[model samples]
Target: MQITVIGAGAWGTALAIAASRQPHAHRVVLHARDAAQAQAMQQMRRNERYLPGIDLPAALTITSGPLDALLPSARAEDLFIIATPMAGLRSTLQALQGVPASVAWLCKGFEAGTGLMPHEVQAQVAPQLHAGALNGPSFAQEVARTQPTALVAASPHASVREALVQAFHGSALRVYANDDIVGVEVGGAVKNVLAIATGLCDGLDLGLNARAALITRGLAEMTRLGVALGAKAETFMGLSGLGDLVLTATGDLSRNRQVGLLLAKGLSLEQAVTSLGHVAEGVYSARTVHQRASQLGVDMPITEAVVALLDGRLKAFDAVQVLMGRGPRGEAV
Candidate 1:
């Protein structure tokens, strides 16, 4: 099968490498946005800037050509993985409007201005296309190294899910099929925001009890917003939900967690963001998450607090206090 992965960021590169490493000889192409970067990766056989220390497999083709260059390869039997961030999903889908292939994205956040999830954006931009999302707890670096990882291939359409499974699922990587795209996308997106909160909790030297409590409640917030958005409540307990939240909140390699750690250390938001040199989806999508929750009349206290903190209206220490100061209420999911 021919596979084209658009957007050559760390996650995109990792997935391209993984696909190329599959036991079967499937043709795979990794597309970078910049022509120079594409040439560099092709020549050096490594994605040094984003995925340093990982060798690109000989079987993976690297390209920085125009979007039209991908059209010829977009057959019904092939898959186009939009590996761009949430912000680029719309334009990428727009570019692939007429392609006859299953499309999936690696991004896990709402669009910044429109506050749309990846599938929502796809619906608006290219509703005729068969699309879905591949998401779970796995990190780009870990997956690039061929570490064991399990992910959910979520789509209302069975073909998109099956294409994802056929193209990538293998001995070291497991892909589960899920029909709940809304639930999976919600879990994938909200976990980043919750990870920021967890990072702040840990950065403040809060004990294990605090961390556990915050994570449990954070999962509640996620589930609330997800169910309000038409997702299955039980999906929150699955890989894309509980598994992803725990991994992002606690993983040392999480960019969103690193943002909170830097902020807790007295670095300004700008300073922390600039230091990371990559998009931390939590910082960009916290407000949107809060907005969506408010629009849905869902109580997302943690998301509201995160929005406040990200907006510079509240300090990190005060943010914690605000969360703890909320009126005591009965525990509910």
Candidate 2:
């Protein structure tokens, strides 16, 4: 299998390494925006920016012009994983000529305008192609290093899903197959926003009690909206949903959580984002997700608080207070 991964950020680069690690004859091609970075990866056998210490596989190739070079010649079962940010998804889909027979999205976050998941965008933009998503409690650094990790590759077709499981599964990576692509993609994307809330709580030194409350309350919101969108409830309890929610909320490797840390350090949201110098999906996702959840009448206090905090309408502590102040009711919404 020849796997082409678009984008060369932390997660994208890591997925490339994971694909290269597959036992079958494989060529893992990565598209990086920076030609210099691509050239360096070609020479150095490592992604200097994202996975610095981890060694890239020999079969891995990095290219700056993947849209022109890789997308034009995509063949059947030649998996193309778009790991780019959500903002560019539509345009990239538009420009690409040869849509691979099987496409996997490592990208998360809703489409800015349409508020669609990666697979939803794929269906909308390229209806004829087979599409799915790769997601879980995955941190790019750990994946690049071949750390024992569990992830989900979800497609509507069980056969297509299994092929990806077989293509990428190895001793270091534990892959699960599912038909709930919506649950997995939505879980992976929305968790980042919820993670920011927990991250803020932790960074503020708000106590373990506060953090626990936030995570528990956040999961309710996540699951509620996911179910509202037609995702099975059990999917939320699996790796892609609750598993990812817990991990990203507490994991130090999360960019969204790190942003919260910076925010707690007295820097404003804008200042914190500027310092990170990378795309944090949570920031762009917060407003749209909260808006959509509201339209659906789904309970998402954590998301609402995150949005409130970002809009300067709520303080970090006050966000928690706001959640706490929600009228007394039963545990489940």
Candidate 3:
């Protein structure tokens, strides 16, 4: 199988290394938009700007050029994984129009301004393409080191799921197929917003009991919005939902969590974001998530609180106060 990963960020480089190291010797190409970065990775055999300590597998091919030139030779059997951030997904999918290949995206967030999920964006720009999301609790650095990780290969199309499994499932990686793309994508997008809230909870020196309460309620909020958006409720209990929420909210390497921690330390949003040196999806997508939930009449208090905190409308402590001050309601999700 030919696995072409577009975008040479940490996750893309990590997945490319993993695919190249497979015993099946699949052809894996990691494409960087910047020709200079591609040349550096080709010559140095490492993505120093992203996955620094890991060495790129010799079999992995690094390329960069216009999408028009790079994608013309793509075959029907090939898989194209878009590893760009949510902001770049639409443009990338637009470029992939007419390509007879299965596509999957690794980004996990709602699109800003449009408030659309990746699949929704694809439907608008590349509806003919067979696409899905490859999402789970795995981090880019851990995956790059070949750590054991299980991910959901979610698409309405069986062929997309099968191709993702064939290309990625082996050794330290486990790929599970799911036909509920809506459920999978909702879980992916909402978790980032909830993670920011969880980080704030932890940053304020809240007890483990508080953390547990926040995560549980956050899961309920995620399920409510997802179900309102045409996703199955049970899907939130799966890897892409509860699993991803737990990992991103508590994991030390989570950039969204880091943003919350930095904010709690009294840094301005600008300072915290500038210090991270990486795009934290929650910071960018919190407003969109809140907006979509409002439009759908879904109660997403945690996400709403996150949006307020990110927008400077509330302080970290004030956000917690607001959440705690809410009137009692039924426990239904």
Candidate 4:
């Protein structure tokens, strides 16, 4: 029951806390990529950059690399959760090239260079490892706060899914198992882009009418792209897809929404991101996912608009106008 969670971001720190609650009291290690960050988390008992003031469990150890936690001779990992961001997943995996099996990823974004989902990227880099993805509407803050949350643990391998359910599920956290890894991964990643569109609506001071329209239509596009990428339509309606979309778009804690609001109020993308003091996955994913959607012939107007606004090619208001003016079609289209 030894668990190693790689990454020191808000979500990663939250996972460390969650692991500390395991009944058997697993050896939970949080790997901070930055050595200074690791030392700070160990001393302050908080990820001061993101989730501050939350005390960490004494059993939750922080380290800088795989050598510190997953070394073959050292304390081995019975369960390793790769919670690192999408940008560093490949490099992180590469660093653990000799890592043992039973590794899972908590990342929920598509890779930038190849436009691949986290699982796809994982398979490409290390094809032999058993991998699963944990995804849903759950937020890091809520998870850290022990707010009740539900998420799906999905993998093509049945054993991996069941093991994940056993390791993470408990009273405050619920885990559902499924074989549709692509569906869950796609749903989780695309919701971030849709959240950006919702943020723009909020920033513009638009009424509920506009926000409602954007959310509904954004779901449609997300499903379209997800299905085009080999995911199930029903999966988009499940926790990873619809659940995440609604929570992130409407929740006050969403950085994606904050970014959109900032841009709507005349702040540059750089300024907005700087003010947030944390990376908003949607801001970067919107551009990458949008490009992949276009090449796949999936209709993603909302994603397109967000990309335009981020690229400075179109204003937020203009993007809305474009959405409204697009050729009228049936609701299903």
TM-score of every candidate relative to the true structure: 0.99, 0.95, 0.99, 0.95
Mind giving the per-residue lDDT tens digits that candidate 1 earns over 128-210? 99999999999999999989999999999999999999998998899999999999999999999999988888898987898
Candidate 4, residues 272-326, lDDT tens digits: the string is 9999988788887887898889899888888888899999999889988888899
Report how far residue 266 has shifted in candidate 4, in Å: 0.7
lDDT per residue for candidate 2 within 1-333, as digits (tens), equals 677788888889998888888877877788898889889888988888877888888878878964776666677767777787889777666655356557777777887878887777777777777777888998888888888999999999765687678768899998999999888877987899988988889988989998888888777788888889889988988999889999999999888998888777767999989988888999998888887788898878788888999888987778778877888789874
Worst 10 residues of 2 by lDDT: 92-101
What TM value does model 1 have? 0.99
Q: Can you give the lDDT of residue 137 in candidate 3?
A: 89
The Cα local distance difference test for each model comes to 0.92, 0.83, 0.91, 0.83
State residue 275's C-alpha deviation in candidate 2, in Å. 1.6
How far in Å is the alpha carbon of 280 misplaced in model 1?
A: 0.3
Model 1, runs deviating above 4 Å = none
Model 3 TM-score is 0.99
User: Best candidate, lDDT-wise?
Assistant: 1
lDDT by residue (tens digit), candidate 3, 1-333: 689999999999988888888889579989999999999999999999999979999899999998887688888889999999999999999999889999999998888889999999999999999999999988999999989999999999999999999999998999999998888988888888888888888999988998999999999999998889899999999999999999999998999999888888899999999998999998998899899999989888899888889889999999999999999998888
